[model samples]
Target: MVLRKLFRRQAEPDVQIEKGLEKTRKGVFLEITRLFDRSEIDDELFEDLEMLLIQADVGWDVSQRLVKELQDRIAAERIVNPADAREVLRLEMIQLLELATRNRKVKILQRGVPFVILVTGVNGTGKTTSIAKLAQYHQGFGRTVMLAAGDTFRAAAIDQLKVWGERLDCPVIAHQQGADPGAVVFDAMVAAHNRNVDVLIVDTAGRLHTKHNLMAELHKLRKIMQKHVPEAPQEVILVIDATTGQNGLVQANEFSKSVEITDIMISKLDSTARGGIAFSVAKELGTPISYIGTGERATDMAEFRPDTYVDSLFFGEGEGF
Candidate 1:
C-alpha cells in the first residue's frame, strides 16, 4: 500500500498531464464528446467513433476491439441515451490501457549494483534528450548517474551526450568517434564498478530497424555488457517519437526482435495530436511505455501512469483524484 501511494503521489498534477495531452484531447476526445452529445445511438455514431480512434492513431485492431467492447458494455448496462455513453467510453478506455499497464510499476533506481538501461532507437527519435531526462528523473531521487556514449558511429551523438553529462554533472565514458561501441561499453563497466555508480545508461548508435547488420551488432553489444556484469542491462528502453504515429509502432515491433526491450519511452508527445498511438503500441507490441516526453525541457518527462493519463486525456484540465 505504501509503494502504491508513493507511485500515485509521484503522478504529476492533472493540469500538467492534461496540458501535455491537449492536442490529443482536442483532436480526438473532443470529437468523441460531440458524438456522445447526439441523442440517438445509431450506426453513424459508431462509425464516427471508429473513425475518431483511427484518426487519433489508435490503429485498426485496437480501435475495433474497443468499439465492440464499449457496445457490449452499453448494452449490458442498459444505457439508453447515447449521451450517457461518455462514461462508458471512459471506462472502456481505462480498461484498454489497463491491459498494458497492469502490474507494471515503472522501475527507477532500485537498490542494486548499478542498474543499467540500454537506450536505443532509430535516428531523430530524441534518444539523447530522453536519456538526459531519464537521468534527471532518477537524480531527483538522489541516485548517482553515469552515461556511456556507446554511439560511436556518430561523433555528434557522442558530443551531445557529453554536453548532457556536463550539464548533469555526471561522468560520461566515451572514446574517439568510429571506435568500437562494445569496447566503450566494456570500459564503461569498469568505470561504473570503480565509481560504484547507482545507474549506468548506455547510448547506442541509431540504426534502421530493417537493417539486419546493425541489429546483429546491437545483439553483440548486449552480449558484451552481459559478459562483464551478468544481468548488467536490467532494462532495454526503446525511445520512440510519438509524432511518428503508427510508424513508431513498427519500430517498436522490429527493435524488440533484436533487443529484449523491457520498456518503451515515447518522446515528443506534446508535438502530436494523435497520442492515441500510445494505446496501439502498448496493445500490439506488448511493451509498456515507461515514460513520455511532454515538452522540451528535462523536467518535461513523466512516468506513464495509465489511470491519471486516461482521466487527464478524457476530461479537459484537471481530473478527479
Candidate 2:
C-alpha cells in the first residue's frame, strides 16, 4: 500500500513534461492554425484545413475522421466563428491523439537477466545513434549495458557504434563487415549473459521495408533469439525519422508486417518537420510510442506523455505545463 501511494504520487501532473512536448505542439499548431483567421468558416476554409492536415503527415483516413467529426459538431451547434471552430477542432484532435498515447509506459527490465532490446530501422533513421543515446540514458539509471553491432553489412555502421560504445565506456560486440547479423547478436548475448549485464541493445542493419531479403534477415534474427531465450528480445523498437512525415507511416506498416514492433521512437523532431506524424503513426498503427528524440543530445529523448502534449497544443504561449 505504501509503494502504491508513492507510485500514485509520482503520477501527479508534471510541468517539465509539458515543456518537452512544446516542440512537437508548436510545429503542429503552426500548420493547423494557418487555415483559420478572423474570416468566417467556408468551403474553402474546410478544404484548406483538410489539405493542411494531409501535408502535416496526418493520413487521409484519420484526417477525414477528424474533419467529419468537426463538421458534425459545427453543423449541429450552428458554430461559425473561425476561432471557435479552431478550438473545437483542436479539442477533437487532442482526443484523437489521446487514443495513441494510452499505455505508453516502457516495460521495466526484470531482475537477474539482461533485458534484450533489438533495434532496427532503415538506414539514416538514426538507429545506431539512438541506441547509444539509449545506452547513456539507461546507464544514468545505473544499469549495466552492452551494445551489439549486428549491422555488419556496413563497415561504417560498425565503426560508428564502436565509437559510441567507447565514448560511453560500455562494451560492444561486432564482427567483420558483410558478416551475419544474427551471429553478432549471438555473440553479444553470450557476452551479456557471461557478464551478467542488465541490458543488451542489439543494433541491426537498416534496409528499406520493400527489400525482401533485408526483411527476411530481421526474421532470422528473431528466430535465433527464440532459440537461446524464448523471452529474449523483450522489446523490438522501430526508430523512425520524423522528417520523413507521412512516408514514415508507410514504413511502419511494412515493418510491422515483418516483425512485431512493440514500440516506436521518433527521432530528429527538433527540425522543421511537423511532428504530427507521431500522432498519425500511433493512431494508425495502434502501437505505443514510448519515446521521442527531441535533439541530438543524449538527454534529448523523452517519454511520451499525452496530457503534457495536449497542454502544449492548446496553450501554445505558455511554457507547456
Candidate 3:
C-alpha cells in the first residue's frame, strides 16, 4: 500500500511520461479506451479487447493471458458496468508489470569506485544516445560521469560519444577507430580511477546480434573490466528500441546469452505508436526495464515506473489519476 501511494504521487503529473506516450495513447489505445464507453460487457468485448492488445504489439501469449485473467476477475467480482471493467483491466496490466519487476530494483550507484555500465544493442537501436541520456541523468543528481568509447568498429560511434561527452562537459576515453575494444576498456578503467568518476558509461559495438564473433568480443570486454574494478562493469544494460516491437525481445534474448544483461532501457518510446512493447518486455524478459528514452534530448529519460508508464498510455496530463 505504501509503495502504491509513493508511485501515485510521483506519477501524478509526469509530463515526460505523458508526452512520451501521446502517440500511443492517441493511437490504438484510444480505441481501447472507447471499449469501455459501452454500457455492457459481453463476449464480443473480450474478443475485441484481446484483438486490440495483439494489434498494440503486446505479445500473443501475453495478450491472451491478460484477457483471460480480466474475464475471470469480472466474473468473480460480478462486474456489470464497463467503467468498472476498464478499471479491472487497468489493475491487471499493472499487476503484470509488477510481477515481472517484483524484486528487480534498479542498481544503486555505489560509493568510492566508479559505477561502470556496459551498454549493448544492435545497430540503429539508439544505443549511443541512450548512454548520453543516462550520463546526464546521473549528473542531475550531482554525480560526476565519464564515457568510454568502446565501440571502435565504427569511427562514427566513437565520434558520437565524443560529441555527447563534450556537450555534457563530461570527459570521454577513446582510442582510434578499429582499435581493440579491450584496450579501450582497460584504459577507461584506469582513467576512471584517476579521475574518481562516480559513473563510467561504456559504449560497445552494435554489430548484428547473430554474429558469434561479436558476442565473443563482449565477453572479452567483460573480462578486461573485471581485472580493473573486480566487479567492474557493474551493470550490463541492453538498449532495446521500442519501435522494434517483438523483434526487440529477440535482441534482448540474444544479448543475454552473450552477457548477463542486468537491465533494459527502452528507447524511442515517443516515436512508436505501439507502446505496448513495454508490456511485452515486462512479461517476456525476466530482466527489468530500468529506464526509457522519451525523446531526442539528453533530458528525455526517466526511470521505468510501471504505473507512470501504463497510466500514460490511457491518460493525458492531469487525467485518469
Report lDDT per candidate: 0.81, 0.76, 0.86
Measured by TM-score, the strongest candidate is: 3
Candidate No. with top lDDT: 3
What is the C-alpha local distance difference test score of candidate 2?
0.76
Cα-based lDDT at residue 98, candidate 3: 77
**lDDT for each residue of candidate 1 in 1-321, tens digit (9 for 90 to 100):** 445324422336355567678888777877877788777787788889999999999999989988898888788988888867877887788777776666364555445477888999988898889898888777767688999998888889999999989877789999999898889998998898788888899998886345786787788888888886777688888998989999988988888887788888888888988889778977887777778888877667888877767776777754321
Q: How close is candidate 2 to the true structure, as a TM-score?
A: 0.83
**Model 3 pairs whose backbones collide:** none
Model 3 scores worst on lDDT over the 10 consecutive residues at: 4-13
Clash pairs (backbone) in predicted model 1 = none
- What's each prediction's clash count? 0, 0, 0
Q: Give one digit per residue, the lDDT tens place, for model 3 in 6-57.
A: 3322222267777878899989888899988897998999999999999888
Report lDDT (Cα) of residue 151, candidate 2. Answer: 89
| Pairs that clash in candidate 2 | none
In the order shown, the candidates' Cα RMSDs to the true structure are: 4.7, 5.6, 5.5
On TM-score, the stronger of 1 and 2 is 1
lDDT per residue as tens, model 2, 98-143: 7766856557787667888899787888898789878876776778
